[model samples]
Target: MQAKEIPVSKSDLLRADLQESLSHSHIDPAQITTFQRIILTTDGTLTEILEAYLYEKIQLVKLSQEIVASAQEIKALDLNIGTNIMNRKVLLQGKISRRNWIYAESVIVPARLDEIYRERLLKSQEPIGRLWLEHRVETFKEIIDSKRELAGELSDYFLIKSEDKLLSRTYRVFSKGQPIMMITEKFPESYFIDK
Candidate 1:
């Protein structure tokens, strides 16, 4: 699968929205720089970047997986789900050195996938990037939305202050010219700090 160029809006590239959202009311130039490096870099997978940053293996901690009704957003992505489309929700934590650094949720259309890939997704604790690589699936990611907000559970899990918001980006992954999954990743502030 060949890599495709990801289009970015000129406003998004020039705006400080990413920095402002990640840094509460006050902006930190250093943090903004790191934020841009991580969040705005569309060249590689999050697993790859996080692994490089932490200098440790990124482990996928599967929280849960269940079949569910498709949300309007998922449906609107033109996934080509039939009347009985099998939708699965997978919740996972991306951990390094046994510390949970990222919380991710993926909405997958199993019916759109082959039997082998579908089973791997259901049974394995591998990150999506790894799965894609192993299966040789070519994908295009479009970052649809992003936000900075204090999530209580995420903060508690990451041992962060309740007032410190986590930065999150939601993106859709397209393969074979069709939307296959939507993934949302929430990163704690500690991820941006130098160790």
Candidate 2:
């Protein structure tokens, strides 16, 4: 059976002001280049990029994953799973050289996933991109938006002071034409620092 394509809602596109952020930002050119490299690239796992840029082994830390009935916003993504739909909220961190480089949260539709994929997602500490590649799941990513977060829990997690900001992007992953996951990743400014 062919997977049904999930339509992107107009509201979802409008909610993210990515164009303004990318086109009008005053961030340094090098930093902008780094952001584009990380956020714009549809290929390769982020772990690979971090390893190459930071010159260190990356570690995946699974903070939490819990099954929930639904998040209204995630449900709005219109995943094709039937009434059995359940959302998995996953929080994890990527560290390099013992320093946290990225924090990520994902709203995954377990009902839409194959049994093997669901098991791997729940049990593995590997990056999701790596897992997708290992399973040879043909997938496509849609970058919904990007932003500069100046304050909040994410900044606190990165130890950013009041005046500092973190770069972030929100995206969705689709496999077999079905929307399977929604992810938001926040990167610390230190990731762009020159060695």
Candidate 3:
């Protein structure tokens, strides 16, 4: 006749059976018994087998949850980098273009001058374009390098620098003379100005 396999269950009955097996065994009292191999023994406690099975299941559940959370975070990051960033990139690329007018605005200038400035600027085309491009590019590079150095120093936190209007907080573009374009942040995009 074949012997029945052990049923895993936690109860007083299982504990008592384990105690009985230990007492009847010929192993010396001084010997240390490893619990792992004990479960496979013919007289192993039902509670031991049950606890091991439950522990394995709990661990698998925890691992699966972590994977799902990570996948969601990656999807969010993809949208931020792809669509949102592309729009910003296109606008910044015109910085070096001489034909492009740097919209002039400041605390001192009236709102009406905006259209007049553009008209005058269109007529001028690139009177001071070279001078504007040179200074702006140098300033741009300085800001980027400074931020990079700061990043190296901090390493723990993000360090980003960009230009923006102090009061209105709008993106202001300028030229060599009357005004200059001040951006809200550091950019890989640049245009032809002076230096």
Q: Report the number of clashing residue pairs per model.
A: 0, 0, 20
The 10 consecutive residues of candidate 1 with the worst lDDT sum are 83-92
Compared with the true structure, what per-residue lDDT tens digits does model 2 show for residues 1-195?
999999975334422444444434443324455445455334357777777766777777777777766534444357433333433433334453466777787877787788898899888888787788788878877767566667466566566775577777677778888888878777755456543
Q: TM-scores across all candidates?
A: 0.74, 0.73, 0.15
Highest lDDT: give the candidate number: 1
The positional error of residue 143 in candidate 2, measured at the CA in angstroms, is: 0.4
Model 3 lDDT per residue over 82-170, tens place: 22110111111122231211121111122213455534433433322232342332221001000111222212111222321111012
Residue pairs in candidate 1 whose N, alpha carbon or C atoms collide under 3 angstroms: none
Which lDDT value does model 3 have at 193? 17
What do the candidate models score in CA lDDT, each in turn?
0.66, 0.64, 0.24
Cα displacement (Å) at residue 7, model 2: 36
Write the candidate numbers in order of decreasing TM-score.
Answer: 1, 2, 3
Model 1 per-residue lDDT at 94: 44
Model 1 per-residue lDDT tens digits across residues 12-78 = 5533544444344343434454544465435368777777766777878777677756544445367
Flag the better candidate by TM-score, 1 or 2.
1
